[model samples]
Target chain A: MTVMSRNDLLLFLGFTVVVLAMPIWLHPFGAAYPDLLQRFMIYGIFAVGFNILFGLTGYLSFGHAAFFGVGSYAAVWSFKLLSLDAIPAMIFAIVISGLFALIIGYVSLRRSGIYFSILTLAFAQMSYNLAYSVLTPITNGETGLQLTLNDPRYLDRAMFEAAPGQPVPTLLGQSLGGFAGFYFCAGFLILAFFIAQRITSSPFGMMLKGIKSNQTRMNYTGFNTKPYTLAAFVISGMYAGLAGALLAVTDPLAGAERMQWTASGEVVLMTILGGAGTLVGPVIGAWLIKYFENIFSAINENILHRFFDFLPDGVDNVLVAISSKFVGEGWFLTLGLVFVLIVVFLPGGIMEGVRRIAHLFDRSRRSPTKPGKATPHPQPAE
Target chain B: MFEVIFLQFLNGLDKGAAYALIALGLTLVFGTLGVVNFAHGALFMLGAFCAVMFRQLLTLETVTLDPEKLSPWGAPLEIREPLVQAWFGDFGAVLVNYSVPASIIITIPIMLLVGIALERGIIKHFYKRPHAEQILVTFGLAIVAQEVIKSFFGPNPIPQPMPTDLRGAADIGAFLGMQANVITYPIWRLIYFLFSFVIIGGVFAFLQFTTFGMVVRAGMADRETVGLLGINIDRRFTIMFGLAAVVAGLAGVMYTPLLPPNYHIGMDFLVLSFVVVVVGGMGSLPGAVAAGFLLGILQSFASMTQVKALIPGIDQIIIYLVAVVILLVLPRGLFGRRGVMEA
Candidate 1:
């Protein structure tokens, strides 16, 4: 890893402060709760890892949630046997998911384009199906894996007399429930952001970018692209694993649903929705999505009526009736519509929209005093 | 043993027909438009909804309240009569009974308009974009389509019954001069299989005989050359997309009797059909149809108790498993052409 420059350090610092102060800033949006905040951090981590593979390499592995689910299952098993501490769980999750990715990636990397996507999707779906039936001894089938009484947590037993109340996850005897868990997840999110930042700048990252742009050209140039892609795949898989483990660490339950294609699609959407290939975009996208999922789903018919109360009775009823289709139970409709609009009009997603706005501001600042002057086109730094 | 095998084969045929129908349309679009349409499944679901809408329309009744006769806890005695029955009597009843088949009339035009509009509206712009963007936009469109269906239909599976005459099981054994009760199967499923064959045969014959299909096939072979020949290949491709949509819709319309459709049915079928398409080899019409049936029957056989005992949950993921092996072994797919989206 290369040394972080001043700009990189500043960006990291800003990200950290913003994440840490989310509880305060997010209060207005009514999403300051630890669960939703923890989700923002967890999915942010997932999307960041996803960005490293997708944004850099342009290998859209549709089966990433397999690793995420494996991570969660690994974490829960670690809690079942090793320790209730999140550190060991995270470690176990990352290592297991990394290996899982290595095998899947080795085979899947042989193919490219849609075939690669399908290959990954097939593997993940297989894993999910297996977890539900054949692997039920470990996965507990549809019931999912959860911490139960009489589990042998030898490490915790060695240190303490009995498990803590509520069987909450801990960090070296410090309780990690509630806001503490949020911070723990936030810490990993920041770390993930930093690592992603470092990788995005590294030479290896450039190789991945080259592979994304044109693998044939790189191949003709005599560079072995497989190992580079495989490495990125493993690293991103590890990130997904860590995110999954964190999900289990906070909730202490793992389900097969996490391995489903929809879960993988969610991460992909988060990455694209934020603007793939751009640092902080996936995180921002993940945050915005989580916020809307939490807040918009909570908007019931009563809330819509309240929102539309300012209009006349007839108009209010009509407006509320129409708007009601895109909120509450229909929140997914809003998400789909927004995502479609974003992909259609703004292919670069939220990041591109932000860039255009920023560019406009910059252009206005430069050409304010002049009329009909050609604005200098400079390459915008991603 | 023979009975079990034959029954599973029939089951597979039933499933394969549906899969082949869906995959056929998918491959058609992929071959013609060169776009990965994730919304193809949504088109299938919309076709199913057309059936639902047709039935609802047929059964729509007029209600009148009579002040002379009031019911208990009622303002007035209400009388309800089906408007179709009142208008056409016996024919109206027959129309109601055969709504599933009749829905094809509405589904064709609707799906065509949808496919053409979709091609012209969203997909036309995406032709120059990356495959990732194409997938994302279509995937987004799919989600929107399903959600809109959910909002309108309220996320519940709406069952469409097979026609009354086709409701009971047919004694296939008797037809084949075996035991009377042996090898019995539902009449509707058999009809569905035949319907799919007719549709598939029609498509192939159309392509084989028609001048239009020849030109379209030529365009599929080489779009640039066909364009240089002073032919409007793009418009034909757009029409091909509409034809694909009609195939998907008709499949959906017929499939309602087998599996009640909710908003999510399209997605469920979409994944399996993609597997079929890939296994059959992308852009190969015959391959899609063959793979759909092969996988479908294999899936049915895998669900047998003996098979399940040997390999638990194999039935649940047989298609994906087959897809993975095929993709790894034969990168171009089973019957995939040399360079049809192979890169």
Candidate 2:
């Protein structure tokens, strides 16, 4: 392992502390609000995994939802057949999602660029359609698979009690605790983040980067790039699966909507909107988007009127009219504008903007002389 | 059983025309500009709205007064004239009665302008971006466009009826001495099929015959070389993008009467058309058309009781099944050129 400077070590410790403290710090807010923080963390984990494949390897798998949906179904099924313990259910979900990814990524990775995207999209839509119709017995179709209170849970069945008319055990016979769910989700997200960090720094991750930059160069160097890319694809898919398992653990249901192409597109947007190649960027991106979707969407006209009551009548009406387009039914329009602006202006995403700001401050504080010309600091900080 | 099969086959062709038209436009854009225009479906929706606009225009009258009102003694009541006359006159005008044909004529220029504006306004900026960005921006544009249309047209499928002459089904099966209902295909559907074939032919012939097309084909192969030759290929590509938009729009206009035009009809068709493009081999026009019809027929057949008995929900997935099988077998799609996506 490489030695790190004091500042670097402190930064690492700082990030770790934040990750560990998030659930506890946000617990009060999360408790009052219900599952907002938990959902963000889960989707953040999902986006991080997606970024590994798309941001690193440049192979955008539009069928990622297939893995996600599969993972959820697998997790729920494990609770039904094997145990209600989160560990085994999560393991089953990851393994199944990884297996599904292996098959889909194997086929899709054969093509490159738009064709590859289309192929994966086709596969995802197929999964969605099949789950809605053909695979109803396993997937439970449009109604989605729900936990039954009466299930013969091989483990922890005695610990759980059935609610009246409930078909499945609820949260291992304990009352549904908000803080517990938040912590559980936060723990998994931290684990996923660490895994993603480790993977991006590993030799296999380097190989994937090489494939992204120039596959022909890798081929010339006598490395078979397909298997490496495919492996990355599957691993990332498994990470997505883990996120899916976490979702099911939090919510205890799986629906066909999870497998839709729109869901796949959502992840891609998160990855890109954050810095695709940056480790923490996707997490931030996911959190921001989820927050917008949850919070901004809840503000109705009455709430707006209450907030702006001090203003005069005509001006207040005008303000409401203008602000209405930024929320409620017009949120998607604003979202589209945001996406376009991001893509057109900040190609490297929010992280790039952060990097530029950091550099600007660093440049202003430093000596006037160019570093490479007169000083030992030959490189501007990466 | 045979009658049912024959009916489905006709139904398949009607659907196939739509697939073929959209796929044709997509392929043209892909072939020339190397862009997979995800917003093609939105453009199709816009085209349908154009037809709706025309329909509204033709139906508009300031005051449609009735002169049949009478007093107690049966004296006829006087009626005031309408403030504004019918725009296209009445049933005596061919264009007023025959809306489909009229829509086609109007939609072509309208679609052409829309295509040009879209190419210049938005898609032009994305020319150098990655395919993912292209997809994202176009997808965003699609949502915005659809929302705009929805705001204007409302969230409903606006039905436009075919001409009375073409309202009933053709009696081809009866003339052929088969069961009377064997091939009772609608005349409008047949008109759409013929229109599709004509447009497809015209698009192909234009690309195949024109000098401008020669340059485009050259550019698609090696853009840098074509640029070095001082051809200014981007302009041609922009035009090609517009042409592609027109193609999608025209498809939407003709298709409005067959199936009512809705805001999301484009999105519903987007996935299927992209599938057709891939099955036809990316950037291959003939491949798109062939794959469109092939998948259309397969889908129709899959919906049959015979196929559904074997594989339940096969109809919903037949296109994907065929896509998977084709990809497995051919790898680069059915007609994809070698080295296109070999990596």
Candidate 3:
């Protein structure tokens, strides 16, 4: 493992504080609710993991949701068989998802670009279909894999006597829910982010970037690019798995829908819409998308009426009617529009927009001091 | 057993026709424009909705007072009659009954316009971007298109019944000089298969016989060389994109009778069609067609009782399994060109 620099360490600590305090910060927005907050952290971790492979390596895996789903399944099984403690479940998830990613990445890495994407897609779909149908005994099919009261839970039994009511996943004996769940997810997200940051700044990260820039050139120079990409793929898969495990830890249900192509597409959208290859971009993208999904989908005509209540009656009605098409059931439309606009206008995504705004401010501040300096500085001093 | 096999084979052919049509269009776009269009399936769904919209248009109604019939709480009863029937009488009734087929005429023009608009408005800008970017933008477009349809038509599948004349089953056993009803299939399915063949054949013939198509084919092989030869290849490529969209749309329109038109129908077929395209070999027209049918038949066979019994969940993942194996062994698909999208 590479040691973090002072600046990197500070940045990691700052990120940790922000993530841990998200509930407090988001309380005003009314989005600090446990379920949504946990989701933000979990998906943030997923996007960060996805960025590891897609951002650095430029290999787009369209089937990452399989790993996520597999992780969830593994975690649920651990809960059912071993213990309600999230540690073992999460470890099982990471290991299983890593193994699955190794197998898939080994096969998919044979081809690059779109072919690789299609291959991963095929594999993911196969897993999804199997989970939905043939593996119904394990997955429990359409109803999903849920914790049954009769589950053996050997470790839980050995460690402590069973409590009354339905069993929930926990850290030691403290049940994971509400703020505790969010914090748990935040801890994992921070760990995942720190690992991702190290990977981005490491020598291995440079090699991956080289492969992304020109794999052919790297190959000609006697570098075995395969293992590097596969490593990235596996690492990212493990990240996705960890996120999935967290999901199961927070809420003990594992649905096959998580492995669907649409779910995979959602991650891709997050990575791109937040700016691929950027450290913070994917996490921000995940947060924005999850926020939109939770918030926009909940907005109704009634809410719209309240929002525009102070306007004239006819005007209010018309505004509410028009806005109604972009929220609630129309949230997907809004998402699609945002996706298209981002890809079309700002291919670098929100991170790029942020960078551009920062650039403008930097230039505005420096122009007053150095009026005659015509040459734009390519690299700004950190 | 023979009868079962024969029936499954027929079923496979019908399914294959759909896969082949969609994949064929996909191959055309990839070959000509060098862009992997994720929204091609959306075009297919839009085509199906066109049929739905046409049916709605033909069945537009008007109310009139019928003085002879009085409602319990009203002075006179209002009878609703189709505006088409009121205008064209018997011909209008016939038109309404055959709306699925009649929609074909309108669907072609509308789909063509849609194809042109999509190519011009969005895809034209993305021709130079990376495949990933193309995929993202087009996937976004697909979602938007699907959602728009959902908002308009709701999420339910709208059943578009076949014409009354084509409602019954066709006895393949009788046609094959065997006992009747042993090997039977729906009349509409046969029509769909035949229609796919005609359309596929027409597309092939158009490419092989026409001068414009020759230039497009040349462009596909070497874009720069074609451009250097003073031929306006971009315009031809745009037209090809529209043609491909029309092909996908027409496939969807005709498919309404087989599977009801739904907003998510395109997405359901999208992944399968992409699999078909890859298994057929990227940028290979014949490969796409062949793979489409082969996978379709293979899927049907996998779903057989004996097959499923032998390999519990084989039916669900047969296509993907085959794709994985073929991709591993062949890499370029069955007919994929060397170095095409190898980067």
Best-fitting candidate, measured by DockQ? 3
The reply for model 1, stretches above 4 Å from the true place, is A368-382, B65-78
lDDT of 1 by residue, A290-355 (tens): 999988998888989998889999999999999999999999999998999999999888999999
Scoring model 2 with DockQ, what do you get?
0.56
lDDT of 1 by residue, B253-274 (tens): 9999999989999998898898
lDDT score at residue B303, model 3, on the 0-100 scale: 91
Candidate 3 at A100: error in angstroms?
1.3
- Residues B1-343 of candidate 2 have per-residue lDDT tens digits of 7777777877788688789889988888877776668899998889888889888766654543355888567766555432223343454256656766787778888888888888888778877777888888788788778767765687888999888788898887998898676577788888888889998899878878999888888888898999999999989988888888888989898898878988888988988999898888887788999888888877888888888999888898889878877876777677888766454
Task: Give the alpha carbon lDDT tens digit for every residue of B212-246 in model 3.
Answer: 88999999999999999999999999999999989
User: Which regions of candidate 2 fall more than 4 Å away from where they truly are?
Assistant: A1-12, A19-32, A156-176, A302-323, A367-382, B1-6, B56-101, B175-179, B221-230
Between candidates 1 and 2, the one scoring higher on DockQ is 1
A1-382: candidate 2 lDDT, tens digit per residue: 5455575456456667876677566565442344887788789889989998998998877888888899999999998887776778888999999999998888888778876888898889999999999899999988999888777766655655534664432344553347677667777887787677767777888988998899889999999998888888888999889888888888889999999988998888788788888888898889878877766677778888888899999988888877766677666666667777887788788999999999888876674656565456665667
- The fraction of reference interface contacts (C-alpha pairs within 8 A across chains A and B) present in each candidate is 0.81, 0.58, 0.87
lDDT, model 2, position B330: 79
Give the range of the ten consecutive residues with the poorest summed lDDT in model 3 chain B: B334-343
DockQ of 1: 0.81
